[model samples]
Target: MQDNDITVLVVEDDDIDYMTVKRSFSKRKIMNPMVRAIDGVEALELLKGKKIGYPYIILLDLKMPRMGGLEFLEKLRADSELKDTVVFVLTTSKDEDDIHYSYEKNVAGYFLKEEASDSMMSLVDMLDGYWRIVQFPTK
Candidate 1:
């Protein structure tokens, strides 16, 4: 699949972080469509609805006002339809337990939010290259 064929579902509550990601995408010229959710509950709603298409990757944050990322991952994994969805944890939490739990839930990767914007741009670049070569299951 091509990079444009992949969508990014950013499940985060921090306005700054969200904007940072948006800025990073813009700076890197990553034109992939992006959808934002304030928390896990909203993310789930969007996923269950038809607003976003398949072959999407989730950039999930672990902490939020409502349902947290781990809770969301649990619910998501329980659902057969969404269990195989690709998810990457992007959060400020550096707790080992959080990392363990996220990996246990089968996240694609875990990243710290303290990373520099240059790092973020690199991440976007990597993701663009990744989606271009990887294949996602048809929904």
Candidate 2:
């Protein structure tokens, strides 16, 4: 479940942001499999029936079409099966309400997209070590 061994599902709607992350990964030489979902609906659909190995972390955006991040989080949290999955809000929003709400939802972390860019590789590297030691349930 190392960073490279973990699958990162990025639930972001912005094309530019998606590309930025992609490019950053390449530049940083992160070997993890990265999945992209344009919105909440698509993200959920992509997750259906997927049996990903544990220590998987979700990089979620708070705003999008079909369903916003908060709504998505609510629904995701409601499902017992997905409750243990770790999620971090990776967004451009600096709004206090958004931050508070995400934390209230029990998100593992709240990361600002802009600030994250500066040390994206470092963060990914750190995740590599931690994920390798963690475990998740499988059905």
lDDT of each: 0.90, 0.78
> Which sections of candidate 2 miss by over 4 Å?
1-3, 51-55, 137-139
Off by over 4 Å in 1: none
C-alpha positional error of residue 101 in candidate 2 after TM-score superposition, expressed in Å: 1.0
Most accurate candidate by TM-score: 1
Could you tell me which residue pairs clash in candidate 2?
Answer: none
lDDT tens digits, residues 1-139, model 1?
Answer: 5668788999999999999999988887889899999999999999888577778999999999889999999999998888999999998999999999999999999988876677677678778778888888777
- Per lDDT, the best of the predicted structures is 1
Predict model 1's lDDT versus the native. 0.90
| Residue pairs with clashing backbones, model 1 | none
Deviation of model 1 at 95, angstroms: 0.2
| lDDT tens digits by residue: candidate 2, 43-115 | 7776665744444678899889899899888888888878667897888789999999998889988877765
Count clashing pairs, candidate 2: 0
In order, what is each prediction's RMSD in angstroms? 1.1, 2.4
